[model samples]
Structure formats: C-alpha cells, structure tokens
Target: MADKVVVFDFGGVLIDWNPDYLYRQLITDDTERRRFLTEVCSLDWITQQDGGQPIAKGTAELVARFPEHESLIRAFYERWHEMIRGVLEEGVALVDKLEAAGVPLFGLTNWSDETFPWAWERFSVLRRFRDVVVSGRVKLAKPDPAIYAEMYSRIQQQVPGVAPQDIVFIDDNVKNTRAASALGWHGVHHTSAGATEVQLRELGLAFA
Candidate 1:
C-alpha cells in the first residue's frame, strides 16, 4: 500500500481567520457591525471572492452598492491581514508532529487568491505542506468533488504512487470531509486538535 498522505484545510483548521475579528475593530457599534457583515460582506459575497473574483473588483462593486459604507467595504480587503489572528497552536503542533514523523503533508483550502498571500506570509506552518491547492486559484471550492479530484491529481503527479484512497483529508466542515470520503479518501471532520490526533492514531498514523 502507498504511504497515507494527510491533507489539511487552511482557514478554520490550521489558522484562525474570522472576519469579525477585523470588523470589531472597524465598526464600534456591535449592532451595526453585525448588520454590515450580514448585509454588505455576506458569506455568499466573500465566497465569490474565494472563487477567484478579484478582491479589488468585489470591494469596488460592494462600495458602489452600499455607497454610505464605502470605507467599510474597502477595509474588508484593505486590512485583510488583520483577520488572520494566528496559527492554532494545537493544530500547528499536530502538523509539526506529522511532518516530523515523515508523513506527507498537503493542503486544500478555500481561500482568496489575492488575500491568501497575507496568511501564507504570516504562517510558516503552511510552508510545511508539500503542495496546496487553493480554491481561488482554481476557481473551485470545497464540498465540490472537482476540487478534491484536482488536489488528488496534483498529489499523484508529485508523489509517484499516491492514490485518492491513500489521502486522509481533514476539514472543519462536515460537507467537505464527506465529499472527500465519497471520493474514496479517508476523511476526518476536525473538531479539535486532540480529536483529530485520536482519529489519526486510529488510522495507524503515529505522531509525537
């Protein structure tokens, strides 16, 4: 059997990225901040950016739509770095342990092509991954079989004998993990580092 590879999700799994962290600083009023995030910078709108829409263009269109909150809309991508608080220490430790044990590490994330650089620059742990497939770069997001297939294909090309069934995908979202599982890849619905560690152990992957 080929050596099992571990695939990680970027945002909620390894790094701590919450737009509310940035919005809280910009919008002093709690009610207004909630409203602004809901009506203006909704998750659906941001997902479009993750799906390869240029950040500048998206922000400009939002500003045009909500002229009163022009500055706030601009701040969404302007100060995007602030949204990334830091790496989740527990998750990072798991990655470190896995890497130390010689497990092949890969990443599959739904991140904006433009903003991903900021997180990539800030987190050194990301560099540990042998390869990462960014949704924005490919214009394909998770829960979609195509993105997972693309990632599998990339891994197979780089890691000679690797197969879809050899990959163990970890993600915070159940849908993404389920999709990977459906593709014959082992999937871990990551809730916590400890829980994930247990699952890996169960899979017979050793880690310090």
Candidate 2:
C-alpha cells in the first residue's frame, strides 16, 4: 500500500479568515456592517474571486452596482490581509506533529488569486505544504470534483506511488469533505484541532 498523505484546506481549517473581522473595523454600526456584508460584499460575490476573477474587476463590478458603497467595496480587496486574523495554533501544532511523523503535507484552498499573495506573505505555515492548489490560480473551487482531482493528480506527481485512496482530505465544509470522500479520499470534517487530531490518530497516523 502507498503511504498516506494529508491534504488540508487553508481558510477555516488552518487559518482564521473572517471578513467580519475587517468589516467590523471599517463599518462602525453593527447593523450597517452586517448589511454591507450581506447585500454588497457577500460570500457569493467573494466566491467569484475565488473562482479566478481578478480583485480589481470584482471590486469595480460591485462598485458599479452599489456606487454608494464604492469605498467599502474597494477596501474589501485593498485591506484583504487584515481579514485573516492568524493561523490556528492548534491546527498548526497538529500539522507540526504530522510533519515530525514524516507525513507528507499538501494544501487545497479556495482563495482569490490576487489576494492570496497577502496570505502567502503573512503565513509561514503554508510554506510547509509540499504543494498547494489555489482555486483562483486553477480556476476551480471545492465542492467541484475537478479541483479535488487536480489536487490528487498533483499529489501523485509530487509523491510517487501515492494513490487517491491513500490521501486524507481535511476541510471545514461538509460539502467539500463529502466531495473528497466521493473521490475515494478519506475525508475529515474539521470541527476542532483536538477532534481532528483524534480522527488522524484513528487513521493510524502517529502524533505525539
């Protein structure tokens, strides 16, 4: 049997990325902040960026639609790095354990091509991954089987003899995890670092 490899999702799984953290600072009124996030810079809108839309174009389109909220929309990408609070220490520690145990690490994340640089610059833990498939760069996102297949292929290429079934994918979204499971990869629906550590242990991955 080929050795098992661990695949991780970046956003909620390893990093604490919340737009509200940045939006709350920009828009003082809680109600108005919520409104802006919901009606203007929504998750759906951001997903487009993740799907390879340039931040410049996305912000411009949103500004054209909601002209009055232009500045707010511009701030979305301009100050995007501020949205990421930091790496989840527990998650990082788990990764560290996996690394120490000689397990190969890889990342698969639905992040904007333009804004990913900010994260790439801020977080050193991301560098630990042997390879990372970014949605924006590849123009594919999670819950889409293509991206998962791409990740599997990339891993296979990097780690010779590894098969799809030998990979364990960890993601915060159940849909993404399910999609991975459908692809024959072991899926871990990450709730907490401790829980994930338990799951990895169950899989026979030694972590001290």
Candidate 3:
C-alpha cells in the first residue's frame, strides 16, 4: 500500500455544525422553521458566505430580500457560535490515530472566513492539521473544480512532486468527494466515523 496524504473536510467530518442548532432556539414551530431554513436562509444562500462573500453583505442582502424575517436573518451570524455544538469526537479520534501513526494530515473546508476564526479558537483539534485550505479564505468552495485544483496546488506546495492519486480526501458531502475523485485523488464519502475508518484502513491507513 502506498503512503497516502490524508485530507479532511472539517464540518460534518470533524466538527458538528448545523444552522438548525441556532434556528431551534429562534424558531419553535418545526414546520415554520423548516420553511424559513429552506426558503429564507437556505443552504444555497449560506454557500455564498462560504465561498467568500462578506458576512455583513450576505446578511444585509438576505434581510433586504426577506424583510419579514429581518430578526431571524440578523441572528444567523450574531448567534453563529450556537450553531457549532462541538467537535465530532469520533472523527477527532481518527485524526489523533492518524497523527499518532505519523500520517500527514491536511484540512480542506468550505467555511466562511468571518466565522472560521471562532471555530479555530474553540476547536483545538483543528490546529492538528499540518496545513488547512479554507475555501472562504481562498475565495473558493467545494464541488467546484477550481477549489479542488486549488487544494491540489496547495498540497503540492508542502509535498513537492506529490501526485493527486497519492492524496485521499474525506468529505461528508458525496458531491465534494466526487469532485476530489475526479481530480485523481482517492475520495472517501464519510457517512460515519466507523465507516470512514474502514475505508481508510482498506486504503492502507492504520488506526487503532
């Protein structure tokens, strides 16, 4: 088995973050909450922030469009910390196991530059990565070919002459993983820690 460089997606793979965590406190009605999340503050809208749009600009535009949900929209960022419950312990354990085995670890995440700092300060596990390529910081997001190319380039900066095939990227979103696979990198669609561990083990990554 070849020595592989491991790249991890932070959100679902390592950190437990969800807008619902914040919405639940703001919007009590399940149906109404679902409607607001899907229609007003949708994932598509949030992805803009994740792709480098300023949080204030995004929020202001959203509030303008949905004047009725002004308070809710404002609270999205003001109360952003509530959205992140904590690190996914199992996933962090994988990082620890890999680190213990001397595996080279890197991070690729589609997170807002404005909000990522909070996570960086809160989650010590995030600091373990040798290098982290943040989408918002780089003005690129996943599922976009450009972002994957950017990640490849960044990895090359650290590991000169490293082929894309020598990298294994783990992402919770299948679309993102598929994008990585298209770039000749081994992509693991992480559903759960146990399942991800199994796949990594098969690829010559040993974790105890």
lDDT of each: 0.90, 0.90, 0.92
The TM-score between candidate 2 and the true structure equals 0.91
Candidate 1 per-residue C-alpha lDDT over 1-208 given as tens digits, one digit per residue, 9 for 90 to 100: 5578999998888999889899998898999999989999997788889889988888888888999999889888888888878999999999989999999899999989988887888799998898999999999888889999899888988788887778999999898899999999999999999999999888888767
The list of candidate 2 runs beyond 4 A from truth reads none
Scored by Cα lDDT, where does model 2 land?
0.90
Poorest 10 consecutive residues of model 2 by lDDT?
199-208
Estimate the lDDT of model 1.
0.90
Rank candidates by lDDT, best first.
Answer: 3, 2, 1
RMSD of each: 2.1, 1.8, 1.2
Clashes per candidate (backbone, < 3 Å)? 0, 0, 0
What is candidate 1's CA lDDT for residue 204? Answer: 80
Would you list the clashing residue pairs of candidate 3? none
lDDT of 1 at 162: 80
Pairs clashing within candidate 1 = none
TM-score of each: 0.89, 0.91, 0.95
